[model samples]
Target chain A: MARRKGVESSIALADAVAMCKVDAISAYPITPQTHIVEHLSEWVNDGELDAEFIPVESEHSAMSAALGTSAVGARTFTATSSQGLALMHEILFIAPAMRLPVVMAVANRSLSGPISIWNDHSDIMAERDIGWIQIFAENGQECFDLTPACFKIAEDKRVILPTILNFDGFIVSHMIEPIEYWEQETFDKFLPEFEPQIRLDVKNPSTMGAVGVPEIYYEARMAQHMALVNSKPVIKEVFAEVSQITGREYKVVESYNMEKAEVALVMMGSLTETAMTAVNNLKAKGIEVGIVRPRLWRPFPTEEFLEVLGDISVIGCVDRAYTFGAASHPVASEVKSVLYTSDKRPQVREYVMGIGGRDVRIEEIEDMFMQLIEVKNTGKDFPIQYIGVRE
Target chain B: MEHLNVFASKLVPGRELFSPGHKACQGCAPALALRYLLKAAGPNTVVANATGCMEIISSAYPDIAWGVPWIHVAFENAAAVASGVESGIKVLQRKGKLAPGKVNVVAIGGDGGTFDIGLQALSGMLERGHDVLYLCYDNEAYMNTGIQRSSGTPMFASTTTSPAGEKVPGQSTGKKDLAAIAAAHNVSYVATANTSYPFDFMAKVDKAFSTSGSKLIHIFAPCPTGWRCQPSDIIKLGRLASQTGLFPLYEYQDGKYTMSEDLPFLKPIEKYLKLQGRYRHLSKEQIEIIQENINQRYEWLQKLSRVSQED
Candidate 1:
C-alpha cells in the first residue's frame, strides 16, 4: 500500500512519474504546466529519478524530441498547456500515427487572442482530433493517479498509442489535496518494465514514420483509428487492474446520484467535482438532480453516456470550451450529436460556464439544475446559456 | 593517417545504406551527397530525416530507400529528433538493453529545413551536445515545394519566391553563413563539404563520427531542376562552386579552422554563376557585386584559418 499525504497535484504528478521510472522527458516551460516539469527536473537533477530531461526550446521541438526518444524504445514524457500545446499541434498527430506510446500531461488552459492565462477546456478541445487516448481528471487524487495510469494505458501492447491526461490548469494542477504517493515497489505491480515491440534498433533495421502514399494512406489512417477505438477495452482493463491495486475504483464515465433522477448536469474536468456538491444541495431540497462526468474524453464512452441518460428527461451540459460558430459548445455539442441518433434521447440544454478560470459556484450549478428541471417540466429546451456572462 | 586526396581510390565499401531505384532527379547532388555520407557512416547508423526532397524521394510508404533504421518525422525537427534518438540510446545502453558504441545517430535536412524552420531545433541539439551528426544538404532553396527561396539561397540567385525582375533582383541577401553559425556553438566538429568533392566530404564524415559529441556537416548540393541548369551540368556546377571561391571546402574543429581543399587561385565567380540559368540574367554590375562578395568572404575565411594556425 502507498502512503497517503497531502500535496499539490503537480508535485503528486511528478512523484507518480518518478515512481513510474520513465526513460526520458523533453519539455518546454508553459504556464500552469511549468510546475509539473519543474518538479520533475529537480528530481532528475537530484538523482531521485534516473532520467534525461531535455530542456527543449519550444513545444514544437519538445514533442519532436519526445517522438525521437519514444521511437528508440524509451518510455518518454512531456507536459504543456495552451499555446504550448497548440504549438505542438503538428507533431501531436505524428505521435499516434507512428504508434509511439508517449505519455503527456496537458494542464487545460484557454487558447489566446485575448491572451488569458487561466484555466479552460479550449486547449485540449482544440486538439481533440489528434488521435491520442485523452482523459480528464476532476481532482488532485485523479490527477495524481491518472499520471501513472496514462503510461500504463499508453504502453500496453494492445494500445501502443500515445495518451494525454488533461487536468484543469489551476483547479486540479495547482490545488493541494490528499493524494496517495506510490512507492516504486507498488508501481512495479501496476506497470512492469517497458519492453518496446518496435523501435529503432541497429541490429534489426526498420523504417518508421515513412510517408503514406495516396494508395495506402486511407488504410493507414483507418488502422490508426481502429487502434484508438480498440484501446477502449485496454483502458478499462488497466483502470480495473489499477483499482484492484489501489482500492479506488475508476471508470470511463462516472455517475453521481443518477439513480431515479429526472434531471441532471453533464460535465467533465474539475467542474464535475463542484457539480457533485450542487447535486447534494439540490437533493436536500427534493430536486433529485445528478451529475454525469465523462472521465474518458477521446474514445468517448458514447454507449455509457447514452446508458446514463436513460430514463432521464433533461440534461444540462456544462462546457468550458466554446465551439466558436457552432450551434453549441464542445461537450454539449458532442452530447447532443451522440443523442441525435439515439433512441432514448434526453432534452439536453447547453450551459457554457466557468470559462477562463471563472469559479463554478455551487449556487450556479444549482441554478443550472433548476434550469434543467424547468426545461423538463415545460418540455422546451432553453437556448445555450453563457453562465456568469455579463449581459 | 592517409591523406584525404587519396580517399577516392581508397575503395568505398560495396554495402549501400541508401538503396538504388529511388526517386531523385537526374544528377541530383543531394542524392549523391547522401550516398557518400552513408558510405562513411556505414550501416550501424540510424538516421532522422526531415521532410524534404530526400525524405519524399526515399520514403514513399511501400518503397523505402533506407537500408539502415531511419525515421522521417516532419520538416523542421530532424535535429531535435536526432537528439532524442541519441539520448534514448544512451539510457538504453546504460541499462544494458543496448550495446554501446555500435550505432551513431544522424539527422539530415534540406536548406529550408536547416537554415530556416529547423534552425532552432538544430541550435538546441548542438548546444545540448548530443552525439549526433546533423547533415544539411544545402540545395540553396526549397526544391521539393517548387523551388522557393530559402535563407540559404545566395544573393542574385533566382528562385520562385525571389525572382529577378525590372524592379527586384533575385535574392537581395547573401547566403546565411550556417557553417560559422554552427561553429559559434563550439561543437566538437563542424564542416562545409560539397558533392563535387565526394572524397573530401566522406573524409570529414569519418572524422566527425570518430568523436562522441555534436557535429554538423553542411554539404553544397546543387539542384539542376530548381537552378534551371542542365542535368549534365549538376556535378560540374558543384565543382565550379568550390573552385570559384563561391563555396569553400573547410572545417572547424576545436576552435581551429582548416581548409581541406584551398585553391592556389580562385577562378572568376562568373565561371560558377554562368552555368546555371538561375544567375543567367545577372548584369555586369550585379556579377561584380557577387564576385566582390565572394572575394570578401574568402578573405575573411583565410584570416580565420591563419589566426587559428597562429594560436
Candidate 2:
C-alpha cells in the first residue's frame, strides 16, 4: 500500500512499479530516467520491494535482460532516456514479437547532435513503429497513474504486448506533484496477478522467438500488428478500471473547453497543459479556442481523434519533434493521415515547436491559434512551419 | 541393475534436447558439439541462442528442433538474456514460487555474435557474476551470412569479405583471443575445446555446470563449406588444428591453468593449413609468418600454464 502524498513524479513512478509487484528490473543510468531506477534499486536493497534489480552495463542489455526475465514468466520493468532508449532499439522489437509483456518508461529526450539532455519527443518519436503500446503522460499525476495501467494492459491475455510510457524529460519527469497513490487492495482488484501464456518451463517446454523464414515471416508480422491494434480496447478498459478504484478518470483522447469552439489545437505530452492554459486565456478574451491531446499514441486513437475534431473548422497541431526531409512532422503527420480520407476533414496546420528543449510558452501557443484562425478564414494552408526559430 | 541398464538404453536424457532432422549442413561440427554439450548438461536446462546459423537452422517457425524450453532473442544479447534468466530463477526459487532443481542456464552464440558484437554483454554478464555458461561456437567466420569475416576470423584466411588478391592477402588481422578476454574477467571457469574430441568438450561442459558463477567455453567448430574442405575432414581438421599448436585445448579454473592433453611434439603448421581451400592462396612467406605467430602464442600459453600451476 502506498501513502497518498506529494512526491517527485519519478519516485511516484517507481513506487507504482513497486506496488504492482514487478518481479525483475533491469536498468542503466541515463538522465531524467535515472531517478526512477535509482529509487527501484533503493527499494530492492532496503527490502521494501521483493524483486531482482539487474544493474546492467548498457540500455541494450537492459532491454535484453527484461526480455529474458519476462520470457521466464516474471513481471519485468525497465526505464531509459534519449540515447539509452535509442540503444535499446533492436531489442525493443523482440519484446512484443515474443509477447513478453515487459513494461518500460521512456523519459522523452532529444537525440544527439550538438547533444542536449533536456526534454523533447525525438527519442520516442524515432521509435514510433517499433510495435509497443506507446502512451504519453501530460503531468506528474498521469505519470504515477499510467505506470500501473501499462503493466495491466500489457500482461492481459488478450493483449500480451510490451508497453512504453513516454513522459517529457526534465518537464514532468523531474517535477514534484501531489499524486493519488493506490493501496494494495485497490491495485490488486484493478490489475490481477500476471499469468504468462508461455514460459521456459521444463514440464511444458516450448520454443519462442524462433526463426521466421520467408514462408511465415509475413504472417508472423501480421499477427503481431493485429495484436497491437487489438490492444486499444484492453488499454481503455484497464484505464477505466484503475480510474474506478482511484477517482482519477482517463480517456484515449481528452478535450479541453471544446464546447461550441471554432478553432482547436492538437498536441501531446506536457505541452498540452500549456496549450490548455492558452485556450483558457483565449476563452477569457472571447476567442473560442480549445485543445485536444491524445494520451494513447501507438494504437493511435483514430476513431476518437476524428470524433473530437468533428465540427471544428481549424485544427492546429503542435509537434515537439521533426522528421527531417519528410513532408510533415510526427504527430501532425499521423493526424493528417487519419483525416486524409475522412469527409469531415478540417483545415489542418502543423507547427513544429519544441525541438531539443526549446521553450513553447502560452504566448507561442496563442500565436499558433492565431495562425490557424487565419488559415481557416483565408483557406490558405501553409507549409509545415517551426515556432520560436531565430530567423 | 538390469532395470537401470534398460532404462538408460531407452531413455537417454538431454540427447533428445537437440533433435535430428534440422537444417544444419552435413557433418556440421557445431551440431555435434552442441549435442555433446546438451548431453552433459542433462534435461533440466534452459538455453538462449543468438541469431546465427544455429538458431536459424534449428528453429524455422512451426518446425522447431529444440526439445527443451529455449529462446532466441537476437544477435549480441544471448549473454545478457542468460544473466536475466539465471537471476530470475534464483529470485523465484528464493520466493518459493519456482520449483527448486539443478536447472542450468546456457547461452549459445556463433563467432560473430560472441567475439565481436556480443563481447560487451558477455563482459557485463561475467563481471556481474551471474550463474550462466556461455558457449561460443567458433566456426572461424560468419558462415551463416555467406562466409563474411568477423573478429574471430583467422589471419590470411580467405572469406567473402576478405578475398585474397594481388594487392591484399586474405584476412589482414589475427583472430581475437577471446579465451584470454574471458579469463581477464576473473570468472570461475574458462576453457577452450574442439568438436573432434567429444570427451574433452563434455568434460569441460560438466565442469562448467558444476561450478557456480560465470563460466565460458570457447569451442573450435570448423565449417566445411566456409573452409572449402571436404565434409569428411571436419573432425580431422579439428584434431589437426589442435595438434599443430593453432587451437590448444585447455581450461582455466580457480586461477589455475590445466591442459586437457599436452603436446609431446608440435606438428608442422603446414599439415593443418593445407587441408583448407581458404588458406590455399597463402604463399611460402605468408605460411611461415602464420607459423611464427602460432608458435609465439603457443609459447605464451605454456608459460602461463606453468606460472599458474606453480602458484
Candidate 3:
C-alpha cells in the first residue's frame, strides 16, 4: 500500500491544487480531463485558489487565450485530453517556439474519429517531437509530485519551453489515491513567480511576432534548437533541487531492481505500476528481472538509460500506443536508435500494451517474462504481442 | 482659399517620417497621405506598418525609409501586434520608464490587408481601447499582388479575377463598410477621406490625434495601374470619386455625425467610372444603379447627421 487516506489509490487533484495554490488557470471542457478542471473552476469561483480563470470556448481558443495571457507575463496552466489536444496541436508547436513556460495537465486518452474514450498513448504519441518537455506519471502521487517540478524545469531560463504532465485516462486521472500534499508556502520557495524578459508594455512600444526574411530566419530557428539541447542539463539540476526540498529522489529514467537482471522490462506512464508488480512477482521465483520507466520523453534520456541498463541481455519494450503497421510503437523505434551506439546492445523486443483503456493484467506481464525466458533459452527473438486485446 | 492653404501646408511640411526613394508607384496616394499625415501628427510617433506595398517598399533589405522607430509585423495580425506595442507603452508610461509626451501609435495597412485579412485582429485591438490611430489607405484591390480584386473594390470595378466577362460584369458587391465596423467597435473617431481632398483629410488626422481611445481614418487612395488609367490621372480619378459622391468624406464621434466636406451637389458618376478601365464595360443602367446606391448611402448619412444635431 502507498500509505492510507480513503482507498489509498483515490485522492482529488482539486484537493491537492487547493493546497498547492495556482496563480492562473485556462480551461475548456474535454472528456477524461473535465473532472480535473471542474474542481479547479469551483475553487476559482468560490474565492479559494485566488487565480485568474479564463473560461474559453474551444480547445484551440483556450490554448490561444492561455498563450495570450502567458505572453503578458503570468504563471499559467490548463488541462485537456485526446481531441482537445489535437485541436491545440498548432499552438502546441507555437507555445514552445515562443519559449513561454506554461504548465499543462494531460489526462492521456485515445484520439478518435471512430470515437473511443479510453486510456492510451495515441494522443501524446502524435506530439512526441513538438519540442515540448513531456513527463508521464504512474499514479496520482507522481502526478502531484511532477507538477511542482514541472514549473522548475520549464522556467529555468535555459528551458523556457512549455511542459506537459501526463497521467493515464481512467487509470490515473479518474482513480483516487492518497497523495502527500505540499503547502502554498512550500511551493512559493520551490516554484517562484514567473517574470518574462519581453512582455507587452504599453509605455515603451516594442514589436513582437514579426515575420523574418531569410536573413534572420535561420538564426531564430538555431536559437530555439540550442535552447532545447541546453535544457537537458538544467532539467537534471532542477530534479536534484526538488529532491533536496521534498526528500523524494527522481531522475529522467527511474530504475527498479535493474542490477543483476538478465531480462529488463521498459515502459512508461501508469502501466509501469502494474509492470513493477509483475517484476517483483517474477523476482521472487528466481527469475532475474528489472523495470525502467521513462518519465521525460521529449529530451529522450539516451545516455542515462544506457548507463543504468548496462550488462542487460534482453530489453522488452512496452508502449501504450499501437503504431498501426510498423516494427513496433513510437517508443520502441526510438529505443532502437538509443541502443545503436552502445557497445553491448541488448536484444530489443517490442510489445504493444494496454491500448484503448484495456486492463493490463498481472498474468499478461508474467506471461511476457516466460516468453522472453523461452526466447533466451532457445536463442530466438521474442514475438511481439499486444498485452490486452479482444482477439 | 483658407482651407486650401491649411491643406497645402500639411502637404509641404519640412519633415518626412516616411522617407522618399521607396518603391510606391509614381503618385501613389498612400505615399502622399503619409507625407501629409506625418506633418499633421508630427515626428515623435510610433508607426506599425502592415505587410503590404508600404512595408515592402519602406523596409526592403536593410534600408529603412521610416525615419522614426517603426515596426513591420505580419499581414493579418498587425493590429494585434500594434496592440501589444501600445499596451507595452501604456505599462511603461505607468512606471517612470518612459519619457512624458502624448505618444501616437499609427497602424497603417492597405485595402486588402485591412478590410479582408486583418479584420479580426483590428476588431480585437479596437475592443481593447488602445489610444491608437488606425489609417487604412484603401486602393480598392490587391494592387501589391498585381491588381487582384479585394473586399474594398467598388461595385462595377474590374480586376484580373473580377473582370467584366460573359457571365458577370465586374465586381457586383459594394465596398466593405469599414468605417461602420470601426464605429460599431464604438471608437472615439471614425472618418472616410481621399488624397484629392488633402485639407479635409489632414483636419480629421488632427482630430484623431487630439481624441483619445481608438480612431480610424480610411483614405480612398486611387491606384492608376491597377485601375488601368494614365499614371497622371491619379489625382483626377480621386477628385472625381469624391465629386461624384461615390466616395464621400465624413467623420463620426461617439454616434455624432459631421460631414467634413460639404458635397455641394453631386456631379455625373460617369466622369468617375469612365476614366478607369475597371468600370469601362459597365452599361448606362449599371452606372445609374451604382449612382443611385451612392445617393442612397449619402441620404442615410444626412439622416444620421439630423439625428445627431436634433437636440
Candidate 4:
C-alpha cells in the first residue's frame, strides 16, 4: 500500500478523483468546497490526473458546465455548499430533469441564518425537491467509498438523474480515517464505459433541450418525474453490485444490528458513528438498542426504512437540521409520513441535535435511546427534545 | 414585423414557436424577435434559454408557449447549456445514433443575460467553437426586473436603475459593442439585426443558423414598458430606431461586412427617441450629441462594407 496517511474530506475527494483519473470536473469556488478544487487543480498541474477542470464563476455555471460535459459523453463531477448549492438551486432542478448522471459532492453546511460556516444539513435539505439522488456519509471512509459508487448510481441506465454524495462540513470533511482503497481495474469492471442513452452530437443532430409548448409541457415534466421515481429500483441494484465487488454491504436504509430490537435510533450523516458508539455501550449493559442510518435521503427509501424499523415500537428520529416550525424536524416529518401506511408503525420521538456544529456526544445519543425506550414503555409524549444546549 | 415574403405573399406555415399569454407588456420587442427567430430557425431547432423573462414566460407553470424542445438554465449559462446539447448531439452523431445535420441548437437571451451576466459562458462557447447560434435580443434594459439598466443600456437612456435626475441623466454610458466583441473572438459569424426590419433580422438569423461554428446575433428589441411608449408603438419604434440609423442592420461573415439594408438617406435621431419616456428628458443639445455619435459610428461602419466600390 502507498504509505498510510490521513486525508481531509476535501483532500480525500481530490485524491479519489486523482486516483480514479476522472475525466472532467466543472467547479465553482464556494468556501469549504474550494479546498477540494485547489487540490484537484494541483493534481492537474502536476500531471497527476488528465481532466478538464472548468473554473466557473458561479455555482449555476458549474452545474451547467457539468451538464454540458456529461452530455458530451464525458464523466463529470463538482462540489458546492450552502449558498452555492442554493445558487445552483435552479440548475439542480435541470441536471436531474435532463437525466444527466453527473456526480457532485456537497459539503453539507447550514443555510444562512446569521450566516454560519460550520456543519449542518440546511443546504441539502433545501435541495430535497430538486430530484437529485442524495446520499449522506458518516465519515471520511464512507465519503471515499461512496464517491465512485455515486458515479455508478447516477450513471445507471435505468436511473440517470444526477446524484450527490454529501458529507457534513468540518465534521467528516476535515476529519481523517482508514479506507480500503480499490484499484482502477476493479472500477473498470465495476462501471463499464459510460454508454449514455441520451447524448448530444453533430452527426445525429438531435436537440437535447427544446421549448415545449403547453400542449406537451405536463407530459414532459411528468416523464422526468417518473424517470426519477423509477430510479429507486436502480439504486438498490447499484448498491447490490457495489457490495458484491467491494464486499461492503450497503443499503438505502441500513440497519446496524437492529433485529429483535425494542427501540431503534434513526438518523443520517456522520453522527451515526457517534450514535453507534452509544448503541454499543448501552447494549453491553443489556439495553436492547439499534440504529437505522439513512444513506439515501432522496427517494426516501420508504420500503427499506419500513423493513429496518420492522416491528419496532419507538424510533428516535434525530435530525441534525431544523425546519423552523414545520410539523417537526425535516427528517422527523418525513419519517412519520413514510410510516403512515404501515400496520406496525412506531411511536416516533423527534430529537433535534448537532445543529451549527454542536458536538454530538456518545452520552447524548445514549440518553436519546433511553428516552425512546421510555416513550415506548410509558405511552407518554414529550415535546421535541433539544440535546446539549447551554443555558 | 417586416414582411420578408413581400412579393410572394407566402405565410410562414407552422405552429407558433413563441405564443401568447406571456407576462410581458402588450408588445415587447423580444417577443417579436423570438417570433422572427422561430420563423427563420424553423421548428427543427432547440432553444436553450437563460433564466430571464423569455424563459419565465414560455415555461410558466401549467403552460408552455414554445413548440420545440426548450430548456432554461440559470441566468448566465444558456451558452454553456447549448454547448452541452450541441456536444451531446455531436457524440450521438459520432455513434451513428442521432441523425446528422437535421437539428440546430439556439441560445436566446436578453441584453442583460447575454451582454453582461452570460458573457463568460457565451465567450467560452464561441471559443470552444460549438455549432450553436447565440441570439441576444437586446431590449437595452433588464426589463424582467422592472426595466433596470444593463451593460447594453444606451448612453443617456433612462431606466429604473439608471434614472434621469437632477444629478444624473439616464444610462450615462454607451451601449456595449457586443457584436464587435463576438467578432473579436474570430467566430464564424456575427451580426447586428433590428426588429424594425424583420426581413433583415430573419436573414441574419437564417445565416447564423446555417453557419457551422458559433454565430451570434444582437437584435435591437424595443420594449414598450422599458421605453415608456404605447404598446402598439413597438414595431414603429423598432423601425424608427433603424430608420434613424440608431440601430443599423448588418452582418459580419467570413471577416467581411455587409450592411443588410442600404441607408442612402435616413430620418433624424429625434424620430427614434421622441416616443419613449426614457429619452423624454433629452434636451436639444443632448439629442444632437446622440445624433452626432450615431453618424460617426455608422460612417465608421460604412468604411468596412467589404465592397465599398461595388456598392
Candidate 5:
C-alpha cells in the first residue's frame, strides 16, 4: 500500500529509488545531495534496500562505478551536487555515449568561482551537451515521482541513455513535504525488470567502449544522437503510463494559466512554483500572465513548447545560470533556437535570476511578468536583465 | 605447478582469451602480459581496461582482440570501473539475477594510467576493499602517446617530455613505488611481476583471482618501441630489469612480504641500462645515482621480507 508521510524531499527521493530495487549505488558526499545518499546508505544498512552502496572516493569514480554496474546489466544510481557534478563531467559523457542506463539525481546548485554551496543551474548548464536525458522537478512530490520515471525512461529498451533528475538544492532537497511513496509491488509493475540489450557477461564476451576509428566514430555518435532524438515518443509513453498509475497528470512541457494571457514566464525547477504565485497574482488583476516550464529539458520538447506558447507575444525566460559573455543564457539560447523556424516566434527576453541561491521573491517574479508585459506593449528591445542584481 | 614454463606452453590454458592479429607494437610486453593474464583468469573474467596501448591495440571497433568481456571507459578509472563490475556481480548474484559463482573482475592499465592519473581511483578501489585484481603494465612511459614521461618512468631514463637535454638528464625523479602504495591500502594481495617471467606472472595472476579482497599486480612490461631497444630483446630487457634490482619481483600478502626470486648478488644496473636507448645519454655519475636508488629500494624489500620470515 502507498503511504503519504511528511518527510524531507531527499529522504522521499531515496525511498522512491529504493522502490525501484537498484542493484548498485555509487555515491560521494556533497551538500544538499548528501542527504539523499545518506538516507540510501541507512536503508542499505537497515536491510531496507538490498543494493551495493559503494562509497566511492570521488564523483568521477562515482559515475565510473555506475558505468561499470550498468554495463554489467545492473540498475545503477548515484547522486551529486555542484562541484561534485563538475567532477563527474568526463564520465557523464561516457555514460550516454556507451548507452548505459544509469540514473542520477543532481541537487541543482551553483558552480564555483567564489565557491558558493547554493542552488543554481550553472552546474547542469555546463553539461548541456553531455547527451543525458535531463529532467527538472518543481517540488518534493515531483522529485519522488520523477525518480522512478527517470529510471524507466533511461532503462527503456528504445532509449538506453543515462538520465539526470534535477531538483533545486536546499529549496526542494532539504525541504520537508508530504510525499506519497509508492509500494514496491506497484513500482515493479510500472517499471519492468532491467533487461539490458548489451552487457558485460562472461558467457557472451564482447568489447564495449572500444576505440571508434574515423570510419565509424561519426556514425556511432549519430546513432546515439538519433536514439535520444527518437526517444521522445518512448518518454511520452512512459510519462502517460506513470500518470495513469499515479492518477496525476504529467507533461513534457507544462503550462499554467497560459489561456488568454499575452505574456508568460518561462523557466524550470522549483522556481516555477514561485512563478505560479506571480501568475495567480497577475490573473487576479486585469493583466494576464502565465508560466511555461519544461519538465523534460533535454531533447528539448520543441513541438510541445511551440504548442504551449499559443498567443503569448513576450516571455521572460528565467535562467539561474549565466552563460558568461554569451548572447543569452543556456535555457534562453535553447528557447530562441527552438522558436527560430516556428511561425509563432515570441519575443524571448533573457532573465538571469536567483543565482548562487539568491531568493527569487514573488514580487521579483511579478516584476518579470510586468517587464514582459512592457516589452509586449512597447515595440522596444531590452538587454538581458540580471534579476535581483544590485546596480 | 612445477611444469609451469613459458617454453612448455602445454601447462597454461590452451584457449587464448586475448586473441591474435591485434595492432600491438612489435614485442609489446604489455600485450604479452594481457595474453598471459587472460590465460590465468580464464573465461569467467570481465576486464575494465584503461585508455592506453592495450586498449587502443586490442579494441579498434570492428576488430577486437579481447575474447572475454572487456570495457574501456576512460584513462583514469579502470579500478573504479572494476569495483563497480565486482559489486554489480555480487548484488546480482545476491538478488538471484546471476548464478552464484566467482567472476574475476580485473582492471588493466599502463603505467601512465595506474601510477599517475588513475592513482586516486585505484586507491579508492583498494581502500573500499572491492573484490578486484588491478593489473598495471608498467612500460616506464606513455608508450601509446609516443614515449612521453610518466611517473613510472625510471630516473634518468630519456622520454620525449623528460628528454636528456643539455642542462638536465632524462626523468628527474625515480619511479613511483606503486606496489608499496597498493600495500599501504592493506589489500589482501599485492605483487610485482615481470612479463619476461611469464610463469611467475601467471602464478601471481592465479593467486590474485583466488583472493577475496582487493589485489594489485604491478608488472614490469618493457616497451621496445618506447625504449628504442631491439624488439626481440624485450625478454632480455625485462629479465635484466629484475636481475639488476632495477625492478624487483616480490609479493605482499596477509601482512607479510616475500621475494618471488632472491638474487645472491645483483647484476650491474649498467647492463640493463645499456640495452635500452632511453638510458644511453646517462653519464657514469647519473648511472651511479640510478644504481644507488635501485640498491636502496631492493635492500628495503629484502629487509621487509627478512622481517616477515623471522615473524
Candidate 6:
C-alpha cells in the first residue's frame, strides 16, 4: 500500500531513494540541493538506511567518490545545484564514459556571475552533451517517481550509464506537495538488488579506467556513444514497468490536448504544469492551443515529438536558459534541429523567459501561445524574444 | 644491523602482484617501489591510482601489469576515490554482500599529485580517518609532464620549469614537508622511506596495512630522467640521499617518532649533489645553504625522537 503524505519535495525524493537500498551516497551541500542530502544523512544516522553517507569536501569529490563506489559494484548517488554542478563538470563526463551507473539529482539553478540562487535551466544547459541519460520532472510527484525509475534504468545491464534527474530549483525542490509514499514490500519488488556486470573484486582482479592510447581511444568513445543511443528502448521499457507498478503513466514526450490544434507550446520541467493551465484558459477563449513537453531531454525523443506535432503549423519553444550568441536558446535550437528533415515541419519560434529566478506568470504563458497563433495567422518571421525583459 | 642469514628473494612472497613488461623508463625507482609495495600488501588489495607515469605504464587499455584490482579515476582525487572504495566495501560487508575479511585499500600518486594538486583530497581523507594507506612516490617533480617543478622539488634543484638560468639558480622555494603535514592531521601512521632500502620500505608498508585508520608513506623515488642523473646511479643516489641526511628515513607512529636507521656521522652533501646534472650548476654558497637546510631538518627529527624517548 502507498500512503499519501504532504511533505517537501526534497524529503519525498530522499525517502524514495532510501527505498531503493543504495549502497553508498556522497554529497556536498549546495543551496536548494542541501535538503535532499540532509534528509538522507538523517536517515543514515538514524540507522534507517543501510548505507554509507560520505560528507565529501566539495562537489568535485562528491562525484569522484561516487565513481569509486559505483565502480566497486555499489549503488551510488549524489545531488547538487548550480555552481556545484559546474564544479563536478570533469567527473560528469568520466562517469558515463566509464559506464558506471551512478544516479544524480540536479536542483536546476542559474549559474553564477550575478550569483543568484533560483530556479532556471542554466545549470543543466551547460552540460547538454555529457553523455548521461538526462530526464526532466514537471512536479514533485514526477520527481519522487523518477528516483527509483532512474536507478532501475541505469542499473540495467543493457544500459550501464549514469542518469541525471533535473527539476527546477527552489520552485520544485522547496515546494510542499502531496506525494504517495511506497510501502516496503512494493518498493522492494520495483527495484531489484543491483548486480554489477564489472566490479572491483579480489578473486577476479581486473583493471578499469585504463589509459586509452590512440589505437583504442576512438573505438572506446564510439562504444560509449552507441551505448547511449541504444539505451532509449531500455528507458522506455523501464518507464512502462514503473507505470504498471505505480499506476501513473510516463512518456518521453508528453502532450496535452494537442489533437486538432493549430498552435502548440513546447517546454520542459515544472513550467509544463503552468502551461497546462494556460492551455485550458486558451480553450475557453475558443483558441486551440496545445502543450508538448519532452520529459526525456537526451536521446531527444524525435519520433514521439514528430508524432505529436501532426498538422500543427506553429510552436513557441520556451527556453529557460540562453545559449548566448547562438542563433537561438538551448531548447529551441534542439527543437529546430529535430524538425529539420520532418515532412510537416512546424514554424518554431524561440522564446527565452524566467531567467535567473525571474517570474513567469500564467498570463506570460498565455501570451506565448497568443504569439504563436499570430505567427501562424500572419506567416511572418520574428526574431528570438526574451520575455519579461525591461527596455 | 646484523647481516641477514637468508637471501632477500627467499623471505617475501614469490608471486608478483605487479607483473613485469610495463613501459617504465629504465631504473625507474617509482616502479621498483610499487613492486615492493604490492608484495607487502599481498593479493587481497584494491588500488586507486592517480593519473601519472605508473597508471599510464601499467594500464594501457589492452594490457595491464597489475595482477591485483586497480582503478585510475583521474589526477588529484586518488585519496577521495580510495575513501569511496573503503566505505563501499565496509557497507557491503555489513550487508553480507561481500565476505568478511581484511582488504587493503591503497591510493598511489606522484609528487605532483600528492604534495601539490592532490593535497586537499589527501588531507580530507586523513582528517575523516578513512581506513586507507596513501602511498606517495616522491620523484620530486612532475616527471610525467617532462619535469615541471612541483612543491616537492628540493630547494636549488633544477627542473624544466625551474631551470637554472643566469638570474635564477634553480627552484627558489624549499620543499614542502609532506610527512609533517600528514602528521599534523593526527593520522595513525606517517613514515618516509627510500627505494634503496627495500626492507625498511616493505616493513613500513606492512605496518601501514596491518594497522587501522588513515596512514601515509612518502617514498623517496629517484627519477633519473627528471633529475638528470645516470640511470645506473638510481640506487646509489637513494642511498646517498639518506647518508647525507638530505632525505631521512623515519616514522611517526602513535604520537612518537623513531628513525629507521641512525647514522653516526653524516656524509657531505656534495657526494649526493655532485652526481646529478641538475645540481651541477650549483655554486659553493648554494651547496652550503642546502646542506644547512638538511642539517636543520634532520636535527628537528632527532629532537622529536629524543622527546619521545624521554617520555
lDDT of 5 by residue, A282-319 (tens): 88887788889999998899999999998778887889
Lowest lDDT 10-residue stretch of candidate 3 chain A: A1-10
Highest lDDT against the true fold, candidate: 5
Could you tell me the TM-score of chain B in model 3? 0.95
Cα-based TM-score, every candidate = 0.98, 0.97, 0.77, 0.77, 0.98, 0.98
Residue A172 displacement (Å), model 4: 2.0
> What DockQ do the predictions score, one after another?
0.84, 0.76, 0.14, 0.24, 0.90, 0.81
Which residue segments of model 1 deviate by more than 4 Å? Answer: B1-9
lDDT: the better of candidates 2 and 5: 5
For all candidates, what are the clash counts? 0, 0, 18, 20, 0, 0
Query: Looking at model 6 chain A, which ten-residue stretch has the lowest summed lDDT?
Result: A341-350
lDDT (tens digit, per residue) of candidate 5 on B193-298: 9999988999999999788999999999999999999999999999998999888999999999999999998999888888889989989998898888888988
Model 2: residues with Cα > 4 Å off, grouped in runs: A1-3, B1-14
Question: Can you write out model 1's per-residue Cα lDDT over B1-311, one digit (the tens) per residue?
Answer: 25643664456876778999899999899999889999999989999999999999999978999988999899999999999999899888887777877687999999999999999999999999999999999999999999999999999889999998888889999899999989999999999999988878998999999887999999999999999988899889998899988999999998999988768889998877888899988999999999998899999998899899896
Q: Which stretches of candidate 3 lie over 4 Å from their true place?
A: A1-29, A32-72, A76-84, A115-119, A169-171, A200-206, A284-289, A320-328, A353-375, A378-391, B1-166, B170-172, B176-262, B267-286, B304-311
Ranking by DockQ: 5, 1, 6, 2, 4, 3
Deviation (Å) of A203 in candidate 6: 0.5
lDDT (0-100) at residue B100 of candidate 1? 78
Tell me the whole-model lDDT of each prediction, alpha carbons only: 0.90, 0.90, 0.77, 0.80, 0.92, 0.91
Counting only residues 3 or more apart in sequence or on different chains, how many pairs clash (N, Cα, C under 3 Å) in candidate 5? 0
RMSD of each: 2.1, 2.6, 5.5, 5.9, 1.7, 1.7
Interface RMSD of each: 0.7, 0.9, 6.0, 5.5, 0.5, 0.7
lDDT ranking, high to low: 5, 6, 1, 2, 4, 3
Backbone clash pairs for candidate 1 read none
Query: Local error of candidate 1 at A275, Å?
Result: 0.8
Output per-candidate TM-scores for chain A, rounded to 2 decimals: 0.98, 0.98, 0.94, 0.95, 0.98, 0.99
Mind giving the per-residue lDDT tens digits that candidate 3 earns over A35-139? Answer: 878888888789776666656555664565465545555566788899999977866876777787778888899989578799899998988877788888788
